[model samples]
Structure formats: C-alpha cells, structure tokens
Target: MSQILKLFNFIRIFWFLILPLVCFGQEKEKPRLELGGAFRVNYVYSSWKEEQKTKGGEFGYDMFRINAKASYKNIFLNAEYRLYSEAFGGGFLKQGWVGYKFNKKDELHAGLVYVPFGIKQYNSHNWFFNITYYVGLEDDHDMGLKYLHTGDKWDYAFAFLKNAEELNFGGGVENSSSRYSYDVVGRNKETNQFNGKVVRKLGQHIKHRIGFSGQYGSLYNIDTNKNGHHYALGLHYEMNWKNWNLKTEAITVSHAPENAPGESNKIIKMGAYGTPYEVASDFNMYTAAVSKKISVNWGPISQIEVYNDFGYMQKKEKEFTDSFQNVTGLLVTAGQVYTYIDYAAGYNHSWLGGNFVDDFSAGNPDAKWEARFNINIGYYF
Candidate 1:
C-alpha cells in the first residue's frame, strides 16, 4: 500500500511539471536570422624600440571576423569566427553557443561561452584591456553549460566548464595552441570548472551596479597525472551618470598546480596566440575605467568618446614584481566606420615591452616603462 501511494504521488507531481514545459515547447514562433562582420586595421608606434620611432612605426592588416545569431521559438544560436595574420594566431572561433530561453528572464547556454566573471562584457576602455587579461581571468571563455537569470534590477549566471576549446580533435596535443582568449594549456590543462556571478542595480538617473563573481577549477598535470586546483573571487562595480560611464573591479586569483619534480609551484604555464608563457600562480588584480561621450558634428563623424583605463597586478609572493598598465584614448564614430586612437603605457608588462613570459611571472623588478601609440580603424556591416 505504501509503495503504491509513493508512486502515485510522484506521477502526480511530474505530470504537473512536465505538461506545461511540453505545451510551451509546442507553441509556434517565427524564426529569425542575423549575420554581421567587420574588417579592421591598425597602426602602431612602439616607444621602447628605436627603429619604430625612427621609421614612423608600421601600419598593417589586423583581422576580419564574422558573427551570426539565429532564433527559432525558444531555441537560439550565436557564433563568431575571426581570421588573424599567421603571426598572430591564424583563424579561430571566438564564440559559438546554442541557447534555450526558459522564459523572458531565464535562459540556458551551452558550448564555448564566456565565463561569468568580473564585469559582464568588458572591464577596460582601451584596446590594450586590463592586467587581468594577460593572467587568463578577464574576458575568458571555455567549453561549458551556463544558466542565466536576468531580472529587472538583478542578473545571475552559473556555469560548469569542462575545459578550454581545442583547435583539433587529436585527443592528444597540438604543436600550436594558437587561439583567442587565454587558457590553461601546455603541460597543464584546466577541467571541471564552476563559475558564478550576481549583480544588483541601484539608483535611477545615477545608476550603479554592484556585483560579485567566483570560480573554482581543477588543474590537470599531464605529466604528474594528478590534479591541482584554482579559484578566484572578484568584486565588480559599474556606474552610469548621464553621459559618463565607469567600470571597476578587484580580483584575487590562486592556482596550485601539481608540477613534476624540480618544477616550481609559484608559477604555471598558460597558452594562446600560438605561444605558451608562465604566469604567477597567485596575485591580486585591480582595474578602473571611466569614459564620457561627446556629441559632435565633424563631417561624417557625429560622436566621440574620451576615456582612460588602468590595470594593476600585485603578486602575493612579495618576491615577484608588480605590473601596471594605463591607456587614454578617444573613440570616434562615423556611420559604419569606427576609430580608436590611444596611447598606452606600462611597467613590467608583457605586450607593452617587458619580457613576455617573465613579465607576468616573476618579472624584472628593475624593468623600465614602455609606451605605445596606436590607432585602430574598423568597418562594420
């Protein structure tokens, strides 16, 4: 009698739960399609190099990219691919995700999707981005499934990422890990990661968003045949006051890798753009950016934005040197043509002039400052 009653109660509860979802899935809706892409070029002047200053810098082709989005009823898709010079990383998929909308405020996403951390879209105002970018925490993505809930004044996302996107299905390793976005690669790999983010908005005219993010993952050592761990916590803030915008965030990251004998655990290897480099295993990062839009009528140009972005990384080891980056720039919008002109400066930074792998790792305590003047122009369609 007791077993029969339990089975009857379970069936009754499932009937009510499954019937509505089955009915909603049957509703007919029109399909939608959208496709877009962009072409961009860059001119850069490296102040740290003597020849660049003497020859007036170099102008070169940057990249071309394609983006697509489609929807059929509650099911939707988004994908993007980019082609860069061979010296950069060749061709790669920036993002490709399939989603299902549970309702107006809830959705589910799967595949290579952005990790919900720090700020939503970005945490920097310049082309150089922030310090967290180099260490593989900001604007990072992975193969994962995500659940999102967006309320009027609150947004929440949770994800479980299996690993980084692999360029080939060799089931082993590739000679080149060239791809977009930083990830744990080389002798070590990332797996079984969980991420969560929550944000709440306040104020009306002077709006502010306070958010928090958390992550935990496993670091698999191919050689050691053991697993280490990594985790990060971040606090994010954003403000919008009329024409001004602000974004700021502080984060602490720790990675403990099971390295082989004679290997140092203070740093781990990360790879992207066909290159692998060492990054400090533990550090605190901070970033802040502010921008203001000015309406103007200058020929085809209608509006321009003036902004500054700053990033800093402080290694917890105390023996390791710190890194700093700052960029001030203007973005001009003229119909389909958008342009960015900026000057970026940094100390103990990789892209800015300090040694690539060493700068973000132990770093050179006596490293001098390096600067770059850059202009990027792109056409969107």
Candidate 2:
C-alpha cells in the first residue's frame, strides 16, 4: 500500500513537532487573550409627554451602547449593540455551550443560549428596566439546542428552537394571524417558527422553568391564509439567605389560526381614492416578575429591588381591523444598587385601550399614553 502510505506521513510529521512543543512546555499560562467589551454614549432630551402616541413616540438622539463578551475553557461569548435616539434599536445576545465534562455531570449547548428562563433577574438589561418594561415573555433569545444536567440537589434543561420570534409592548410583532410593523419586523426576511423548552430543579433554593415554541411560516401580503403558529408557558422562583434575595416569574403567549378571509384587504390608489380597512391579527400574552435583596454597608453590600409586568391581548373572530386590547404595567423601582458595578436611573410606562373579554371590543379609538426614560450602566464578568 505504497509502503504503508509512506510510513503514515512520516509519523504525521514527527507528531506535529514534539507534540505541540511538549504541550506548550507543560501548559500553565493563560490570560493574554483577554479583550472584554462595553461602551455607552448617552445624551438624550426626552419628549412624547404621555397622551397618545403608542410605541415609543418621538425622542431625539442620544443613546449609543456596545458590549462584547468572551470566555475560555468550556466556552462562552456575548454581544449586544444598540444605537437609538430617534433611530430606534435592538440588542441582546448571551451565549454559552460549555460541554466536555461529560463525566462529573453533564453539559451541551448549541447557538444562542440562556436556559433558566427566569428568576435570575439582576442585570436584566440594567435592573429590569428600572421597574417596568414588560418582563417574562421577553427573555429566551432564539436559535437553540440545549441539554444540561447536574446533581447535588437538581438542575436540568432541554431546548430546541429553529426560528422563534418575539417582541412586543407597543413594539408590535404580533403572531397567530399577523401584526407586524416596525418596518415589517425589520425587513421581513421570512422563516416564521419552530420552538421548544424545558427546565426543572428542586431543593437548595427552588427552581422550575418551562417553554414552548412554534412557527410554520408564510406572510407577505395577505393571500387568504399563508400558515401560522405560536405558543409558550412558564413559571420560576428563587430564594437566598445571608444578605437576602427572592425572585418570581410567569409567562404565556398563544397564536395560530389565520387563513386570511373577509379581512385584511391591502390598500392603495392615490390616483382615485379608496384605502382604509385592514386590521386582522389575533394576540395573547401574560408576563410577571419580582425581586428583592437588602443589607447595606459598602464592599459586599446590598439594597436591591421589586418588579412587575402584565399583558393581556384579544382580537380574534376574524380580527376586525386589529387593535382591540393591550394593557401593560411595570412599576416599582429603587435607585442606585450594585452587584457588579452598574449605576442606574429609570422609568417605563405603557397603556393602550380596547377589550370586551374574548368578545373583541369595538375596533379603535383611545390610543395614547406611552412613556420611557432610562439611564443605565453595567460592568460584569
């Protein structure tokens, strides 16, 4: 066989020259690849004095944020970038898939992960939006594939998401029949849904989390039904003692039932005159949050938080001209607290009308009261 393939490529080039420099001279020097990331630029002069102007009405420029993250050994990476000030923005991505210690316990991850689902709210984007920003149904970043198990007390996880999507609180992106606008959910590229989730833990504190995801696809310009689906449910809790800490969470969302019929009739005709009648989209969402911690001093100090969030939606029965009911409330925040160095300031408000309880209220009329004010900073590793 050609002399045994030339003696196996001459012993694989002498075993890559002394086995990688003798394993880097018996390894014991790591920490040169340290290049963390975080940058912020704020300077805003607010407006939209609550009265009426739904989603983030109008506020000038003065918000720039950039964050970078990395870790070695098992594996970790993070990235969040934002730039808003009349331009609007979106950013949030925390990843980890550390697996290899398949003996001591267990681990495995694939793309964009954060499994505990809730009740670990500390720096949830600068202390839960300083007391209001529709919590819960707003975590879980997509692109999934996870599995982790640890024993001593308990810890487990299971997730599988292909193309899940979510974003609300006046910032429309509805599902179950279509309600996308924010530039068509950011330039509609397409790939609707497919989701999954599962978490369980007991003793030594407390834990339990759940999740479900689904997305069929089809959405371009109303064609009497182009496919749809969406669903989720959750529950979580935590406890601690010494300094003191507590947490809570809940979530639910449903969608799937729309084939386009007797509603949504695209409009146009500037040359003549005839356009006004298109709003068929169903909705449903419920969220929650709670936090606590106090024991002040200086170095290892405390004096933490308490939070809230709620969302109820309805507009089925062939969704007659969308926008029926939406109630969002998140109030309760204290100033200045720390854990990993993060200065703070906050305010977020939301309230829109319409609802007759599964009867789908009378359509539209009463749209206003949207507020937001945030000053945040953080440094954690």
Candidate 3:
C-alpha cells in the first residue's frame, strides 16, 4: 500500500510540474512536437542449441518502439517506449525525461534518464553491448536529476539518481524486473547514486575524447534494514580519424551488500528483463573496439560500418572465473533502414550461453566457448 501511494504521489507531482509547460502559459515561438519510432526484427543461431545446426536458426520479431520529442523553447520532453514479446519480458519504457536548458552549454534533466557513466551513447558497436552493460555499469538509466555542461574543449556531467525505473509500468508478473536497462532489483534496491564524469576533446581534424567517470551508490537491503554500498571508477577514450574510429575503456566496480544473516555477501543480486542474477562483489573490466566506415552507392544504401568489439571481466576472488566476449559485426545504413550482422562469442558470459545467475559471480571455470550469429534489421521513421 505504501509503495502504491508513493507511486501515485510521484505521478501527481510530475503532472503538476508539467501541466504549466503543457499549457504554454508564457511566451513561446510555437511548440514543436516530433514523433518517431522503429520496427526491428532479429535472427539468431546459437552454438549451444541442439537444433541450431539442423534447423539453421530462428527468426522473429525483435521489438517495436515509439519515441516522442517535444520542445517549447528551452523546455523539452523526450521519451521512448518499447514493446517486446511475453517470453522476452513484455513491454517497458526505455527512457523518459524532461529537460530545461539554461544556455547553449548548460542543461538540466529530470525524471527517468540515462546514467552518465563510462562511454557516451554506447560502449560497444554491436547490439549485445559489453560485459559492463550486463552488470548494470554501462548504458544504465535511473530516476533522478542530471546536470550537464558542454564547453568548447571540456564536457562535464553530474547526476544524482534516486533509484532505478519504478516497477509500475505495463503488465507483468509481480516484482518482475521486465524493463529496459539493467538495474538492481528484488530485495536489494539501488538508491541515492551519485555520478560524475568529465571529458576533454582534443584536436580538430583527428578528434579525440578522453574521459573519466566515478559513481557511488547505496543498496537498501529490505531484510537487513541497512544500506550497502556500490562504487565504480572508469577510464574511457575515443578517437575518430577520417572514417576510422577507436574506443577503449577500463572500469573497476565493487558491490558490498548488507545481506541477511547467513546469506552470501560475496555476490549481490542484480536483474533486468524478468530475470535475477548474482554478480561478483568486486571485479575489473576492460574493452576495446575499432570500426571503419565505407561509402557505397548501392540503391538506398549509402554507408557500411564494420567493427570488432572485445571485452573481458576479471573477478577479484581467486575461486571465481573470469568472463570474455567478442563481437565482429557490420552495420548497413539505408534510407530509414538499418541492418546489423554480427558473430559474437563468449566464455562464462551472462548472455552468451553461460549460466544466467552465476555467470558473473562464481562462473564455471571449464565453460566451453559458445558462439551466436545474429542479424538485426530495423526501419525507422
């Protein structure tokens, strides 16, 4: 009942705050609203599947999404909602936020927004992302306020995320984490996370972005009635020269959960998309990727991007096994159409055929290498 009340109150406050903006009470140069979305499908062939070699693979609908962006002068609203099949955890909002721009260089965002950590936009070229993503360290989103500043050579971002996305959207199993972006869920919930990141851009023709990110957050263990701590530090680098791009990053994360008596503290529970998993308490991760773009005049297609991404995760405990993932992929871009073809392989990875819950914690040391061939095609409007 209390949680329900809190949700109601949050909705009320949000509506009240946004009501004035909707009315456009003040002077405005006409509000602009833009609606766009994507329809995507996927094909996959996994090595671990018994019928993969014979049946070839499976092809099915991947997702359908709707994105909205409306701006009235300095204030704007951005949101994206996605729908997936029931087996894949059903529907959820990817991200939604309201923003006020103070100036060309400064802005503030409120509501459920992306966490400013590690690399901007994405840490990998392929769809599966990197190991840090599965662990909720990359491309994560939460509910709170964020401040950003973009200078000529230096860019800064600071955010205070109160919590992850609420579990009160769409229809799903009770307490099910069927949503976008990996987050701490179940009994141990994430709260009051503080993130700071800074980047320096160097050179004009051969562009470069060097950045560092750090975050500290709390985990509220419902059973313990106390707060645990989670901290991470990241070093990132990206360089673009002509049609070639390079990205590299290193991150170290530690999670100390205040668990119930006799419960294991070596691993903490984190989850997403209707599944809960255990992650190692302390680990170091690293990734490197390179891509090249080539122009083609084949009908509607205009460009092709080929890339390879590699990531590795090493646990602090000697008994725990490490994780590795590598993806070689190419992206084809046409008018309002995009296609991605990838060959991804992993050993002891959460999404690449390893045990879902224990892959990031005490993973099997003798895990065999598994490969997945995937193709994702989408149309945007």
lDDT of each: 0.85, 0.34, 0.86
Strongest candidate by lDDT: 3
Model 3 lDDT per residue over 1-381, tens place: 443354345446545665676677456466666778899999999998878768999999988777778787888988777777766666777789999999999999999898999898899888788777888877888999999999999999999998888675433222457778878776677889999999999999999999999999998787878899999999999999999999999999998889889988888877777677888889999999999999999999999999999999989999999999999999999999999999999999878888777998999989999999999999999
Q: Pick the candidate with the highest TM-score.
A: 3
TM-score of each: 0.91, 0.25, 0.92
Per-residue CA lDDT of model 2 for 333-376, tens digit only, reads 22332222222222112212222121222344343333334333
Tell how far residue 164 is off in model 1, in angstroms.
1.0
What residue pairs clash in candidate 1, if any at all? Answer: 178-274
Selected candidate, larger TM-score, 1 vs 2: 1
**Model 3 steric clash pairs:** none
Clash tally, candidates in order = 1, 9, 0
Q: Which 10-residue window of candidate 3 scores lowest in summed lDDT? A: 167-176
Query: In model 3, what lDDT does residue 74 have?
Result: 88
Please give the lDDT score for candidate 2: 0.34
